[model samples]
Target: MSGHSKWHNIQAKKGKVDAKRGKIFTKIGKEIVVAVKNGGPSEDTNAKLRDVVAKAKAANMPNDNIQRAIKKAAGELNSVNYETIVYEGYGPEGTAVIVECLTDNKNRTAGNVRYAFSKQGGNMGSTGCVGFMFQSKGEIVIEKTDSTDEDELMMLALDTGAEDFAAEEEVFVVTTAPEDFGKVREALSESGIEFLEAGVKMIPDTYTEIDEETAVKFQKMLDVLEDDEDVQEVYHNAEFPEGWEG
Candidate 1:
């Protein structure tokens, strides 16, 4: 399960670098707008805004874009209201899948998501149909650099209220309670620690290994959902074959 998680994280980062940087920035920008609108433009006084800002930074979103989003949300510029929606489904071979979306038009987003699932031999399910298979937690990944000491980092994370720590081959994974995420991340940042990825994610309890053919179908479904503008995050339990590039 850890290995699969590591592989998925690496692929996600590579996907951002290879083709999805702009889309990622746009998504994070929307998140910033939502955060600012729900709270205020000032991160200092808005805890949600602070968390969004941290997420933006982790995604390498430009400071200018972040500020612009906040201004827009605060009415300094044009803004559009967005709503959060979550869809639960089963992928090929009955692997549990969950997609999180933010959109102004729920009808369009719902159609797109459902099509993505059905086109790849899967089907969208009712809310909570597959949600019970996963847990929501704050996850942080840090690269293993020459200066990174596993023991020291583990101690720091534990001392800073991290719930769990795992040292993977090329990265360190820190798990924290959802509410404690910001506090732990801030403390780690204050100590000059950098994160490759950090966000609240839905983690599956167990993984389901699939054949190559099923993996291809699953990957196609994932790609379709990920390429949708309204989609923010996609989580699943399907594990592909060793060294599967898809």
Candidate 2:
């Protein structure tokens, strides 16, 4: 994969979400509830739930909020049904885009997503239209600190089943198979290495370089989709011009 990993984009948004703490928590809470409904509330027995808990912790979600979400999910007679849906589209400059959403009302979510695409000079496409342009993988980000040992980190990642490793400008990005993500993360944790972000993501196989003008429009389209309550993630193959600050 060229350019930055999806983890980088998500990390950039972390700061923005920090200011809107409630919004972040709400999104995580919904995921937790969905995990509970899919496979009981016990993190020990449910790998998905465990991953969600880890994600919540990484986001700095309060312990109270986590427990409350689990407790409410455990007690619900008829849980809120959130179906996972993937919407594919083309962004400005023919950038392949994918939007992952967890929505109870597919019509509403689809309408909002389609509107965002149309309003931003893009067009929504049929399912699987752009999905083939990306591959699913586990991505982990670790900030470069004074104590970080580049060689040691690389060794740890390789020994722990990481498939690829890259040193970015501000952080080390580790890639692994989706199934190995938890094991790799656990090993890193035991090695006393803290991660800035870790999750499964759709990584583009190839990049489509976009000019400043197209990048601006593409970013606006992303913002519109991200601002929606149901959109969980948005992936794209856009590689903005070098030194472009997004």
Whole-model lDDT values for every prediction: 0.84, 0.83
Give the alpha carbon lDDT tens digit for every residue of 1-246 in model 1.
232255343255375454888888888888887887778789889988888888888778888988877887798334577999999999888999999999999999999999999998899999999999988888888888999888888899989999888877777888888999989988898999988788888888778889889988998898888888999999998878877777
Candidate 2 lDDT over 127-187, as tens digits, reads 9999998989888888898889988899999998998888887889989999999889878
Candidate with top TM-score is: 1
User: Residue 11 error for model 2, in Å?
Assistant: 5.5
Task: For each candidate, give its TM-score against the true structure.
Answer: 0.94, 0.92
